[model samples]
Target: MDKSIEKKYIPLAAYFEAATKDKITLTFSEIETIMGQPLPNASYLNVSWWKKTKPPLKHFTAWTTFGYSVTEIKLGYYVTFEKPTTDSTSSTPDQDSNDHPTYIIRSIELDDARDVIGLYQQLFAETDYMLYGQNENNVSVQSFRKLISKWKVENSGTMLIAIINGEIGGAIAIIGSTIPRKKHCISIKMGVLEKFTNYGIGTALMTEAENWARTRNITRLELSVMKSNQKAISLYQKFGFVIEGERKKSVKIGSNYMDEFYMAKVFD
Candidate 1:
């Protein structure tokens, strides 16, 4: 995945990140000339064509990661990028300019194990939404180092990590298959520190992971989210992961039980 990391989209993301206003629009010719490529035909006819679907469209997350939204895009001449309608609904960072955090997205390496472990510790502490019990298992540098090395061998699993000012803000992993008949299936696990929840870090990590898996011809991407997590559920749905079923009382916290949904996206 590192050798194939999509570099073309980063420039587009940078343009939006540096914009000063709530909205910025560009002509098709302008965007094409700037991006140095031709636009896809579907991009002219369907708005859904711009969405971050499975197999992962190249440009979707680029505009989404920054504050700008792709509101109006068409064939003839133009596209629009607007600050999402309201603050609460926006995936944009919450802070004002001077203090706003800049996120760096990239694939994980063996040396990132220590920081990634610490990150999961902070994430598990933030909520009861994850599959793992808070503080139940200690995160170890050795364990993660070995896990990363194994990914190198299988070429079937991948983990993408997001960093904010040198700290790990979030990470997502897609583990490979163990069974012969289900060889194309993969399960996804993701966790983000609570403070970084709204900054599009999850979107970036998921897109990277999905793209990596899709590039390798994986057929199924699956995950389980605690039913109580509306935000996480919505995010999954946005990426076309549908709910196949739910398990009643699947997660136990204290004396109460919470439900979880088994969701997946199948690529054709």
Candidate 2:
């Protein structure tokens, strides 16, 4: 769960988060009691309320956060929450959310060099989503090692990778200035596999990276994101990053000139 995750649906999110059991059953009145509000009229009338896709009502995401599924819905009467059993018969340690990938978040290590390079290669191939495509990011292992080594040198930077069963789902890293004058600031970039978007890997990676930055006393963390990347911009904003300026017509891809947004997060 995200620390200080915004309570988009306040009472509902709190109720779901506090439950201790793998499965719990509740009646409509019971749920409404927990929510501290009456259920919406549409929630009771629409069959979609019981289904697990994007809830037309935002409050529905609460239980789904913990892998809760409405096993049986009696309309106005009751709802169920259960830990979905996987084909393995046991759920992966962190895979509580239904259909959510089980992933581990950790700081990158020296031994993970090959995996990191492979990730960059994969990201670079996604020409529509990244600044660097295959032709630009194709680098030798020696060169990439030097780059990561530079980030690691003198407390200047660090990387966080999201792994889902031995494969990198996404990755983010911060590069800090070692020079005394700019040591208070850092910047970063990240990408997830096209197939892995909306799985929360990007959010997890940024959460870990921000934790790392704060511990190192970084006061201002910044990044430049393509103006066209609204999803990335929204994620950055959620992490407290603010757009300070825009670089007009900065990136030229084919005949298109795309602007970039300069964003920063400042810690008090």
Best candidate according to TM-score: 1
Instruction: List model 2 lDDT by residue over 1-268, tens digit each.
Output: 5334335345455555655546566777655544434677877887676674563455556767767777777788877767655556455445544545545566665556666788888788774667776768666777766777777767789777776533566888788887899998998989898878887889989988888888988899999999999999999999889999999998888798899999999999
State the lDDT of candidate 1 residue by residue for 1-268, as single tens digits: 1223256555456555655556556776545433334567777777776654334455666666665667776756677777755655344445334344556666676756776777777777887887666788685788878888888887768787776643567888888875677778899999888888787878888888888887877889999999989999999999999999999998898999999999999998
Score each candidate by Cα lDDT: 0.72, 0.73
Question: TM-scores of all models?
Answer: 0.64, 0.63
